[model samples]
Target chain A: MLVYLIRRIGQSIMVVAVMATLVFLAVFAVGDPVAILASPDADQRELEAITTRLGLDRPIYEQFGIFVWNALQGDLGRSFVYAQPAVDVILQRFPATMELALAALILSILLGVPLGVIAGLKPESLLGRSIMTTSIFGFSLPNFWLGLMLILLFAVQLRWLPASGRGETVEVFGVHLSLFTWDGLRHLFLPALTLSLYKASLVIRIAQAGTREVMLQDYVRFARAKGLSYNRIVFVHVLKNMMIPVVTVLGLELGSMIAFAVVTETVFAYPGMGKLLIDSINRLDRPVIVAYLMLTVVIFVIINLVVDLLYAAIDPRVRLTESKG
Target chain B: MSKAVLDVKDLSVSFRTREGLVTAVNSISFSVGAGEVLGLVGESGSGKSVTGLAVLGLIDPPGEIDPRSSIKINERELIGLPEEKLRRVRGKDVAMIFQDPMTTLNPVLRIDTQMIEAIRAHEKISEKAARERARQALEKVGIPSADERLKAYPGQFSGGMRQRVAIATALLNRPTVLVADEPTTALDVTIQAQILSEVQQLCSETGTALVWITHDLSVVAGLADRVAVMYAGRIVEEGPVSAVLEAPIHPYAAGLIGSVPSRNKRGVPLAQIRGMTPSLTNLPPGCPFAPRCDYATDICRSTMPEPTPYEGGRAARCHHPLSAPTPAAA
Candidate 1:
């Protein structure tokens, strides 16, 4: 097991390195950071002095070498806009996005799996058919439109929820968390629900398909023959088997949610890394973009490794192969 | 004879498909006394497996059991029994084992978990007591180091060993009736024979009524006291194993015995059954097996024959029952 983990970590390092190189070079190829930063009224000499100070006067390769060396020492260059270490700027907004993504994910799973399993077990029932129909709408409806509609209904018309902003936050262990308070949750409801809509639909379809297939397995019938209660058979025999793929899909989805929940963040004005990354991109803030992309690569690698381990733990077939290797 | 532990009468099952209601098991009746193994032999789609599933009330939506059919376990009516009531009966009075032992045991679960659950489902036993019984059940099926083997998953065991685990689980509650559907079909020859005898010994020792469903007549010959041969959803012939195999009054049964690859039947191409089992969706006007029976004639083709009794309690469904030398018969 240790050997397998080490091998995975090795592969992850390679993935992170490739992503770092690509993002670094791509950032350089884009719009001038100096132009975006220095004022238009500044004299040419003043502009040259700013460029030299920022290490942009050197050739791209020399600058990249220096950046790589500094990054190795945990120093991504300071953000042009915030004038703070790019990594530190990202860290400050991390909790907001993490909480939102986690809220959405947990909500989707708690709702989707049971509904999907029910639909699968009784695919012909009226309730089951309706569950499936709702999931179809869940998949087809755009998240942005869904977000706006939710804001319009619950916030604007119903006056039940806050439409935008991260409401009140309580700090714990130097981390900002809005999810603990009822008022904060009320504020968070619209955007989190909007982000979760697509995932909930996906989970429903995956769980339904998986449950249907597992329900037909010989062991499931055997379990029934053993006089296992309907609940036991459905939960232990059916759900456990169906969860393997769900875990796989959900684990990989975590990274994507943290990295790409920009639209939802924008709509709600949630202070998350996604919003920070987007603002930096628009301002041509190379240091921030490069740091964010590299961090995303690290997160993806970690999630993939964690998912692989979880897969092995859930499936004895995979576990056997791992031990053998 | 011991009292009949399982009595099935006029049992029929059908599946509602797009084509129409496909009759999978036509009306059939049979019984097995305590400690008796009755082999239900048939070709694929001849309703052999369907009968096994029907006995346990495992037939789900799209498939319906005929209301006219009656299944009794130990003189207790089972047909049309509420699902909750039937569930109590399952793994307590009656249990079923399916083909493909590789899949019969849940791959994700350990052998002990599966067996313990089987015992706990029927009894108010604690986990420790259930685990101890599971260990004994494994030993009863002749699995080596039963206690240790229980901790392992089904994937850890060999194919034959896996089937033994499934059998051990089925027998955990000492069910009055054990319905096995082609339990040995997926196993290798040696393993099949071993499991066959082990199961036979286990059932007789426990006084369980065993309905062994298989297409292998030879397996029935060795393991069953009586045999019922099905052809296109009906039992065409049934009698003591020797009586049915030696003198199959039904032509279809004769063809089946002849087709068994034995040294005695070798070099006899004439003995092989000529055609496939008929499709249930669009069957002939009369006997379902008429197209394949050599003695099929005007009456045989035009009229379906009800099961008729012969000497020594043997029975066959045929207008012209085959005889060794019937000079006067068609």
Candidate 2:
């Protein structure tokens, strides 16, 4: 297991390095930060001064070398707008995105698994048909559109929830968190719901398909023949076996969830890393953009590693490799 | 033989398929007494396994058990019983072990969990008591290191060991009837004999009515007290294992026993039953086995033969029952 972990960590380092190089080249290849940061009325000499001050005058390779050197030494440069370390600026906003992703994942599992199992258990039933139909809609609808629709329905007309922004954060062990307070959850709901609908649909499809297939396995029939109650057979036997595929797919989905919370965050104007990323892009905040991209890459790597470990844990056949078949 | 512990009468299992109503198990009547093993012998598609499933009330739709059929355990009717009551009857009164032990036991769950569930599903006993019974059951099946083995998963066990675990679980509740459908078919030859003996010993000791379903006549020859031979969906012949093996009245049964490698002359070609089982969706007018029977005549094609009893307390479903004289009881 330790060897496996070490190998995974080594792979993650390679992934991070590749991502850093791509993010650096891609950011530099796009619109020049000088044009966006400098005033249009500025004289040529003044523009030159600004360019040199931001180190734009340096050669591309030289600039990349300097960036790499500082990045390796635990400095991701400083954000132009926040006037803080780019890593720190992004980290400050990380919590909001983390909370949103966690909430979305929880909602997806809680709602998707049971509903999916129901659909799988009785595909011909009216309720099962309706659940599957609704899941299709959830899967097809765009995250931004769903976010806007949720806002219009709940916030605009009903006036039940705050339309935008994180509400009333309370300190929890020296970390700011809005999820604990009722007002905060009210704020978190629309955005989290928007983020989760597609994911929930994915879960539903996986669980439903998985449950349907697992239901036909001989063990399931054996379990039934053992006089296990309907609930026990479905929940214990079917659910455990079905969860294998679900976990693999969902683990991969989670990385994309945290990375792509961008669209939902933008639609709801939720203050998170995605919203911060959008603002940094608009202002041509090169350092913040680079740092955010790099962090995202590292996070994806970590998630993949954790998923492999989790797979081994859930499936005994995987963990006990030396055992006879 | 002891008094009947399980009696199945006119049990017919059908599947509604695109082709039409396909009868997998035609009206079949048989009984097993406590401490007795009845080997149900047949070909791949011959309804023997279906009969085993019907005995456990497990014919899931698209498959259905005909309402006209009856399955009784201790004289308690099982056909048309509510799912709730049927479930209670299963695993408790009648447990089943399947063909592929690799698939019979849930791979992810530990051995103890599966065994304990089998016990607790019927009896409302504490987990501790169930665990103890599970442990003892494992030991009964001759699995060494009972405590450690219980903690291990199915994949950890070999194919033969896995089948033993399945047998142990089936016997956990000391069910009155145990339906084992080709449970040893997937095993090695030596493993097959060992498990065959272990199961036979356990059933006789517990007085559990055992229905051993298999296409292997040699297996039945050694293990079963009585044997029923099915062709297509009907029991073509049934009698004491020795009598049927020595002199089968039904031509199909005769062909089956004759095809056994050991029974055939060493230099001659092996005898065989020609023609595949007729599709249940479109059976021939007369006996389902007529197309394959060498003795099939106009009467055999025009009408089916009802099961007829002969000397030696044996029966065969054949208009032209073989004239092989009954041998003296061994």
Candidate 3:
């Protein structure tokens, strides 16, 4: 187990390194950040001084080497747009995005899995067919469009909830949480609900397919023959067996939720990392762009690692097979 | 008979499929007594497995057990029984062992966890007690190092070994009836014989009534106290193992026994039944086997044959019963 963890961590490090190199190259390939930073009225010498100060005058490889060195020390350079450390700027916005993503994920799972299980158990029933049919809308409708529609319905027409922003927040253990308070949750509900609709449907399909397949397995029949209650059989035996596919999808989906939250964030005017990313992109803030790219890569790698580890814990087939190697 | 462990009468199973309602097991009836082994022999679609599943009340919806049918394990009626009572009766009063031991055991669970859960499912026992019983059950099935084997997952065990574990799990609760649906069909020949003998011995020793469902006549000849031959969802012939094997009255049973390779003269081609097993869907009106029988007559084609008694607790479902022949003389 220790060896497997070490091997996984080693692979993750390699993936992060490759991603970092690519992001660095792409950031440099685009027009230099010096153009956006220097004033048009400045003379050539003043522009040269600014370029030298930002180390843009150095050779690309030398600049990259220094970037790597400073990155190792947790410095992803300073954002010219914010005039602050890029990592710090990203960190400041990360909590809101994390809160939203986590809520969306929770909503998706809580709603989708049970609905999927029901649909799978009775795939031919009227309710099952309707659930499945309704899930298609989740797939067909874009999150941005869905977000707008939800805002128009609940916020515009009904006025049941607020339309935009992160609203009020309380600090606990130096972390901003938008959960529990009425104002915070009211602000959060529409965005989270809109984001979850598509993924929840995806989860429903995955869970349905998985449940259907696993139900046919001989072990499930054995469990039934063993006289286990339906609840026990479904929850303990079938649920665990089905989780392998669901968890894999969930891991990939979560990483995607964080990275691709741009549209939803923009739609709601939610001040999140995705919003920060958009502003940085328009300004050609190279440090922020590269940092965001690297951060996303790190998150993807970590999530994948966690999912693989969870496989071993949830399914002994994976764990036993790994131990043999 | 010592005591009837399981009593099933007029049990018919039908499935509501997209094409139509297909009968899988039709008006089948059989019983097992304590320490008695009943071999349910048939071809692939002979409803032998369905019979076993139906006996355990494990048949799900879209595949319905006929409401008129009765399945009583230890005088506790299974038909129309609520799920709660049915569950208690299942692993405690009767248990089922399935084909493909590789699939019968959950791939993700440890042997001990599965076994203990099986034991605890019926009885309220401590995990320690359940584990001890599981260990003993494994050892009973000839698995070595029972304690260590308990910790191993199902995938770690080979095919034969896994089957043994499955058998052990079935026997963990020491239920009165064990309905094994071709449990060793997927095993190596040598391993098949070993498992057959071990299961036979275990059932006798524990007084657990056994319904060993299989397609192999040789296995039934070796293992079962009585043999019931099924064809197209019905029991065509049933009797003591020697009586049925030696003098099968039904033509289908006779055709089955004749096809056994060992019975034919050396260098001669093996005897085979003339036609394929008919499809269960859209079965012809009268006797299902009449089209395939050599001696099928007008009466055979127009009317289903009821089971007629012959001798020595034997019965065969046939319009024109075949002449009884002794195995040694043949």
Candidate 4:
């Protein structure tokens, strides 16, 4: 087990290195760094000074080395647009996006899995067919479109929820709290819901497929023959076996949630890392962009690792063999 | 006679498909007495497995049981019983082991967890007690180091070992009726014989009514007390094992017995059943096997025969059974 852990950690470093290199190359390949550093109106000497100051005048390899070194030392450089530390800016906005993604993931599993199980357990029944049809439509609908629909229906039509922003105000212990604390959660709802709808549909489809596959497996038939209740067979035997593939899809979907949240955040006027990343891109905020890309990559890797751990937990076969090796 | 352990009367099952409602198991009537091994033999798609599944009320959606069909265990009707009650009856009163041990045991779970769950489902017992009983059951099925093996997953065991685990699980509850659906088909001949002997011993010791469903007539001839031969969703021939094997009256049954390789002499070619079993979706108006029967006459093609008794508790469903020819020296 210790050997396996060390091997996995070694592999992770190589993976991160590759990820960093690719991200660096892709970002730089789009345009000349000198052009961004120096505008046409700038004097030649001043342009050269700016290029040198920003390290653009240095060799690409040297610049990359410095960037990697600084990143490892927890310095993400200064934001090109905001003139603040890129790490600080990204960290500040990350919580909102994290909360949204987490909520969306939790909600999706809670709702989608049971729905999928029900549909799979009785594929030809009326309720099962209806769930199948609706989930298909749900999966096909665009996240942005679904977001707008939710906002239009709940915010514009019903006037129940605030259309935008986290909240109007906050209160604790019957005392009014500050805007920063109060407004965050109020604004989080619509955006989270918008993101969750599409995610839930994807999860439902995956779970449904996995459940159906597991249901047809011999063990499930054996469980049935043992006189296990339909509910027990479906939930205990079928659902547990089906989770491996569902977890894989869910892990990938969780990573994509941040990418998908950009559109959703934009639609809701929510301040999340997705929106921050997009704004950084539009403004050519190189430091902020680099910071966001690396953070996203790290999160993706972590989610996959966590999913692997979960696979081990849920399946003893994986655990035993993996431990042995 | 001892009370019938299982009484299946006029049971029919059909599946709803785009083409039409296709009957998989026609009206089949049979009963198993206590401690009797009633072998249900048939080729693929003969509805033997379907019949076993139907008895357990395990048929899922797309398949529906005909309301007219009734299955009684110990004189209590099992058809249309609430799922909760059926679950209680399953494993406890009646249990079934399926073919393919790898597929039969949940791969993700340990044998202990699965067996304990089965034991606790019908009985209120501590996990410790259940585990102990599970170990005993595994030992009874002849698994090596049974206690250690309970912690192992289904994949860790070989095909024969897994089937033994499955059989152990089925017998864990000491069910009165045990239905093994082609349990040995997935095994090699040596392991098959071993498991068969183990099952026969277990059945006689417990006096459990064993329903051994298989396509192998030879296996059933040795293992079963009585035999029922099914063809195209109906029982065509049934009698004592010796009677059915030695003097099969149904043409399909005769063909089946003749097709067994061991029965063929070295100099002569083996007898073969020509043509495939008809699709359930497009069954003929009369006998489902008529098109495949060499002795199929115009009347045989137009009308199906019901189970008609011959002497010695034997029955056959054929208008013209082949008369006994001069016996060849063994």
* Sequence-dependent TM-score of model 1: 0.97
Query: What clash pairs does model 1 have?
Result: none
The alpha-carbon lDDT assigned to residue B297 of candidate 3 equals 92
Ranking of all predicted structures according to TM-score, beginning with the best and ending with the worst: 1, 2, 3, 4
On residues B76-102, what C-alpha lDDT tens digit does candidate 4 reach at each position? 899889888988898988999998876
Query: Which of candidates 1 and 2 reaches a greater DockQ?
Result: 1
Error of 3 at B58 (Å): 1.7
Q: Tell me model 3's lDDT, rounded to 2 decimals.
A: 0.90
DockQ of each: 0.87, 0.84, 0.74, 0.64
lDDT of 3 by residue, B1-330 (tens): 667878999999999998899999999888889999999999989898989999988888889999999998888789999889889988888999888988998887788878888888888999999999899999999999999999998889999999999889888888899999988889999999899999989988999999999888989998899999999999999899998888788989989989989834899999999888999987878889999999999998889888777767778888888885322221
Evaluate residue A147 in candidate 2 and report its C-alpha lDDT on the 0 to 100 scale. Answer: 85
After TM-score superposition, the amount by which residue A90's alpha carbon in candidate 4 deviates from its true location, in angstroms, is 1.6
Q: Model 1 misses residue A149 by how many Å? A: 1.4
Model 4 chain B — which ten-residue stretch has the worst lDDT? B321-330
Task: Give the top-scoring candidate (DockQ).
Answer: 1
lDDT of 4 at A203: 76
Top of the candidates by TM-score = 1
lDDT per residue (tens digit) for residues B171-228 in model 2: 8888999999999999999999999999999998988989999999999999999999
Q: Give the TM-score of candidate 2.
A: 0.96
Candidate 1: fraction of native contacts reproduced: 0.83
The DockQ for candidate 2, computed on C-alphas, is 0.84
- Give the docking tier of candidate 4: medium
